[model samples]
Target: MLTERFRFLLNRFRDRLWVKPLAVCLLSIAVAFVAKFADGTGMAKFTPQISLDSIEALLSIMASSMLVIATFSVSSMVSAYASAANTATPRSFILVVSDDASQNALSTFVGAFIFSIVAITAVKNEYFEKAGLFILFVLTVFIFGLVVVTFVRWVDRIARLGRMGTTIEKVEHATAAALRRRLNAPNLCGVPVRSNLEGLAVYAANVGYVQYIDMAALQIWAEQSKVRVVVAALPGSFAAPNNILAYVIADSAERTDIDSTAVALAFQIGGARLFDDDPRFGLVVLSEIAGRALSPAVNDPGTAICVVGTLVRLFTLWSEPEPVGGKQAPKYDRVEVPELSARDMFDDAFTAIARDGAGVVEVAVRLQKALGALAASGNADLREAAEYHSRLAFKRSQNALSISEDLEAVAKAGNFKTKHAESVSSSDGKQQ
Candidate 1:
């Protein structure tokens, strides 16, 4: 719960524009203070041999150059976000937009510019004329060096930020990470909430995707009230006044005066679902990209195949065992949540791809193989989903393919048994 809370906070912090630059400026100011205070100290002996005029010139040039670079970078980033939404998937725009590298790059540039202005102003005003000259000079050199290094790194990172392959990889990695976490804690580390239990229905005041649930807070409330809280809708569910957000179960009299507002506040509703807690959303976004690539206008089957492989990798992890944690029991014993269904994940991931790529033999083949591989994972749920999708894809491929050879090839792969094996199996069954 604490980890989740921290993750939630960290995620929120990372999405903002001010935090990084603000911190950078604060650090710059601190350095300036250090330089100012070190003025009269013998530490000036270590200061590099540099003229104040040269330092001012360097700072002035950096401040002006960095401003232009920052502006260009922002524009470039905007274009990339637009291209990603149009070419790849709109859901991916968020990841690309919140990219740490891009944000850090921009922040560094802006921060550097601010640092330069402050230092230049201080130098021109004679604030460090007689004292702290060495400290100021040294710090200015360091800042300039940092700016150059950051600019180089930023240039490299910006080039790949919103490209289709990069976007797909980003989505896949995010989804895989989320899936791994879910594999360890399917119910978000809460007690499994029962579906059949009837309790007091709690309604959400707004209509939007449930972005986050403060489970720790909810658990505290449940413990304090001595009642079981069944979360009817988990994060990523669309909630409105009409929807039941949760159910409060009690043994005796109902606590009518207790405001459900606090319970409502626990859920953070947003305009759209995010990939952080919703692995399904990520898978869905990946499928959307494949669907786009397979469109007649694009005809990029290779990308679709690549996406199929990525999905296979994810589901393979899904079939693994829940990672055991430490001896400490889950903190939210009273709160219940449902497990994400493997079938639904399969549906969200492959159903559209199967529908869109039906005519493409290569895609069909790879999809069948991916499903077949998943079927072999031995998790009954995954096996069932794989079998279901394999048959559906097979039927579509049968209709889509005009060539008998391609149809036969796809069917062979889908069956998990080639013609020879099928004949041998028939003979064995008959003999038995």
Candidate 2:
């Protein structure tokens, strides 16, 4: 219900590189002291007497080694982040920054370093008896093993982390998740408002992107106020004071009961767009990567073509059948929510690539065929959008490429015909 705001905050928190490591640091400190309680477990008798010097020596090695390793991990990850932004898109930096492997590796390094420091200090100050020292030693060995395993695995992953392919993969995964969430709950679990609201329009308190909307909260408010709320501004939408976020459909007598502050609070407006609930933002960001690849400075048509295929894979998700019970009745029927536009998604994913790679015949051909694939989807909306974009890409290629043979290949790949395919000549010179 109030998950939208929480989800937004959680996503932002994850984007910050320090959050996970700091949490691990605190946990490490806690575990260092908590291990003292194990002194009374009578477990120390089961093992040979371990000297404090041995533990201190091991901790000293870990403390010094871990500090250096943590510094190295940070440098390597920051380089990867910079590379991803430069090679892909600046918008993709968030994805690279929040990579679980990278973050976990960093956390393990820093957490181990802090734990070593605390354990060394404990041993030096005689903070632990023999039992506690044994427990700390066992935990230290466990952490050491963890560090080795994490470092090895992370090294492999970091090798390709910032590469174009990996970045593209990350973007595709994010887009797919968002697409699935939206397709499953197209109305944001609310009934559709097909007509104009005859009630008061709710203006946003600030001007920014509507990053999230707590529809359940709004539904509760509407129920209390006895109104049918129409959500006008959805996640990924830019909201200004002049823009209407929702329409509170109520009689004049019910209007006085509405709390303006509560309504505005329901919509989480932020300076940037989020991918959690906003599938379109993902599309736009993916397109930005493709656009950057298509740019003359990069001249990486292969990446752009790869991106087109990735985009096709994403759109294909839309045609897949819903899971069991996915069609359940709207939970927030008191509130109205709008669905995403297939056409707009098409524009988001393809328009920039089409325009940017117009002159590149290979990119053009691949894009045309990509659109053709989408056009073949079972969904009529997708088919229509694909058909329109196919013709558009074909037109751009025709204008950009001077060679007749290149234009012919592009057109043939597109398999495009006139608007009235029934009456107009087809690409094969036959009317359908």
Q: TM-score of each candidate?
A: 0.91, 0.93
Which pairs clash inside model 2? none
Taking every candidate in turn, the Cα RMSD to the unseen true structure, in Å, is: 4.5, 3.6
Error of 2 at 182 (Å): 0.6
Off by over 4 Å in 2: 2-5, 251-259, 417-432
- Pick the lDDT winner: 2
Candidate 1 residue-wise lDDT, 120-207, digit = tens = 8888888884448777777778878887898899889888878888899899888988887776767777878664567777999999
Assess the local accuracy of residue 248 in candidate 2 as a C-alpha lDDT between 0 and 100.
79
lDDT (Cα, tens digit) per residue for candidate 2, span 1-432: 666557768988999999999999999999888779977788777856788888989899999999999999999998999999999888888899989999999999999999999989989999998788888888999999999999999999999999999998998898888887777788988988765677677899898999888887887887777777888888999999999888777745445556556778889898888778888888898899889888878888888889888989899988776844575468887788888889999999999999998999899989988888888888899999999998888778767887656777787788744333422234446423
lDDT of 2: 0.85
Worst 10 residues of 2 by lDDT: 417-426
> Cα lDDT for residue 386, model 1?
89
